[model samples]
Target: MNSLFHDRVRGLNQAPLRPHAQYVLYWSQMNRRVSGNHALAHAISLANSLKLPLLVYEALTCTYRQANRRLHTFILEGVPETAKRLAALGAGYVFYLRARKSDSNNTLYRLAENAAALITDDYPTFIAAQHNSSVPAKLSIPYLAVDSSCVIPMNRFEKREYAAYTIRPKVHRLLPEYLKPWDMPVLRQRWNLPLPAFHTEVTAGNIDALVASCEIDHSVAPSLTFRGGALEAEKRLAVFLDRNLRRYSTDRNHPAAHATSNLSPYLHFGMISALDVALAVERHGLENNLSSAEFLEEMIVRRELAFNFARYAGRQTECLSSLPDWARRTLLAHATDERKPCYSREQFERALTHDDIWNATQKELLLRGKMHGYYRMYWGKKIIEWSPTCQDALETMIYLHDKYALDGRDPNTYTGILWCFGLHDRPWGERSIFGQIRFMSYDGMKRKTDSAAYLREIAWLESTGCEPHPLQ
Candidate 1:
């Protein structure tokens, strides 16, 4: 096998470097955190090799699909901490905010003019995937996209995985080799260049105004439950280790138990690295005479499975055409099956359904920007159950996630959404609209989880705009 460094680095363009360049550019397109970042470290190595300083560029534009207040606020919340960290590391930080449709889109090209080589996150989904493909062709210097998104480099998998079981053994075998901490680079040459004119200073106090100034949709508010940043990610990890890890094996499915770490938004935004979280869980488990098996499984195995799927799925990641053969056949076999009380996309979006628990799940997505994993399963299954057609259900799930979820447009988000339509899942017993695709019922959810407690908790959040069990 190749070295992890080599495995992670993929050359996008073959152009030679600019000899008189002032710095090496590191673009934080996906893995936005400063520490435990392989892409950033790789950039540092290149900078040190070239005897040049490093400059990190990040941006939030108004052009992405569903660029709303919720997504904007979560990303901007992490910017201040990122700026502070990069400053301490002696690297130049440029955060370009293209808040309006007419705002300059050439900040990257302009930044590239001063750099020897450019490095960016080798992410598979969303805008990063698009950039990694199109941006390199336009650049004159060598472009490298590095895989910091997965602990084991995503390129190691030759083909897309069918299920968790198929990928688990391979992942475990590679874990010992790659699942260790990364040492971030100490800059040899400090950045001395004057800040670019487009550099938008982002502070907590100004985040609201900045977001408000954006030409994106203003209706969808920021997440009611989660905060975004490296500091916030660390806090959630600390809370999980102290209060949740012990019970995670047994109580994670119980939503009100709060046994799971609420780090999905942070992870999705690259505010925290999986390596750091995994190491912390392992250390805490060893010290406390407890097991972190379940947490590790979910964090590394299941999480990376989603990444692997997205890495291969490409533009069809959100479509029904991506489902497996069995899933397709099963759903097709029952296409004409009768429907009962089908709902429209607006109804699903508004959480207007007869089932209180399902409504609560949608409400959580509406208000909190996420829902407990167990309830999320029920939420998708019921959407499949109630929507006018399977296609409509798939569209509704994708639309809602893209519009509302802080973690949406991520590999995990797409995989989880597709999983509802039986992608990466086996067919179950024949059923009505679902046919052989897996079916979830309210009774099954209630039996397996603390649905009442979850319902009450969600209701409390709705009524008071305050969580009964606050993450703090």
Candidate 2:
């Protein structure tokens, strides 16, 4: 194994590598792209060491909670590109789509039976996290997971970081060592084995039909503003670099400016590696004589902080119990405080809140499958204000994100939602519903941001289901 990826690789099980195995299995659970993938590269190294071919396995099942058209379509959209890339790299690709409960779920086990060792993504949230914990025990071969999600592997941090400030310096200090481009290794043996019978063929043309065939919630549609795939992710990054990078520092907070990278969905889905994005931004910044500090802070520092939180927090990642002492005390102290106009989760989902900004933000999540990072704070704060209790507020935010937001169920999703409740945040001056937790008001949003322009843009999306800005 390469020393660069040593910390990123973790053998989850003690099973020795199978002596007469046919291939090395790289299960694509979270990180799905071929480029800038530490896990895939690690798998190649193992295959070369064993003098065996590599088989990459990817699957999308209908069993996960809130499996819907939006999520399914986005993931399936990435398949054609992934298949092409894997083929070019001389690796076999098997993409399984378990569209119904009756479908066989043993695809992985079947593939693992002949594997030298099993490699997978070391993600901390959603189905990938659950699979990493349980599947390793069941496999007869060695089970390894590689952390390809974060630029700096999550293992480098010994414990959970309280906030970005604590992690920022550590991340910056280590960037020079890890931020370089990935030199994808050559495969020693080509994948000559036949694919399994259960493999589903995915193409751009059949994606809609494939998603429609899935036994998932059909009402929630695919994101109108974003598409999936490594190609699309790279395109979005290019646009951000060419058009938005210069403005990112001054205008990222303004939803109307469209200065932000809008790459959260891509990042969360592992369509692109954070390492790739970071290097691209850094290189672009240096060549253009522009400052990439603010953007890098959010992408590397803040994002990795979320991963650190998710890794240590474990199952409590989404629970209010994961909050800091000050946050828990403040929220509990104000638990009984009366909400002026409490709304049901359904109402919030429907974007029926009296506040225009809040409703627009929800609508943006509905239409775009993501909200602007800055306004998301306001969106969360308002949810806390209108919900009956802090716990209720927390549940509502998670449920909404899990079901609707393209970037939902991510470490950032949980951290950002919890930040609304003061996780990784310091206590502020006393307040009514929020206690010492930070609060945002409609007036504050209106004063600081271009609320009117955002409203108009969202209104356009709501009416036309089309992006008013070409690059958005």
- Write model 2 residue lDDT over 1-472, tens digit each, in one string: 7888998988899998988999999999998899988899999999998999999999999999899999999999999999999999999999999999999989999999999999999999989999999999998899999999998999999998888788988998988888888699999899888899999999999999998898999999889988989999999999999999999999998999989998999999999999999999999999999999999999999899999999999999999999999999988888899898999999999999898999999999998899999899999998999999888889999999999988899999999999999888898999898899998978889999999999999999999989997758
* Per-candidate alpha-carbon RMSD to the true structure: 1.4, 0.8
Assess the local accuracy of residue 391 in candidate 2 as a C-alpha lDDT between 0 and 100.
Answer: 82
Instruction: Tell me, by TM-score, which candidate is best.
Output: 2
lDDT of 1 at 130: 95
Q: In model 2, which regions exceed 4 Å deviation?
A: none
Q: Model 1 lDDT vs. the true structure?
A: 0.90
Candidate 1 — which residues are off by over 4 angstroms?
1-4
Best by lDDT: 2
lDDT string for model 1 (1-472, tens) is: 1244898999999999999999999999998899888888999888988999999999999999999999999999999999999989999999999999998989999999989999999999989999999999999999999998888889999899999999999999999988776577678999999989999999999999999999999999888888888999999999999998999999999988998998898899999998889999998999999998899999999999999999888988878888998888888887888778888898889989999999999999999998889888889999888887888888888899999998888899889988988987887888888888888988888888889988998899899988887783
Model 2 poorest ten-residue lDDT run:
173-182
lDDT scores of the candidates, listed in order: 0.90, 0.93
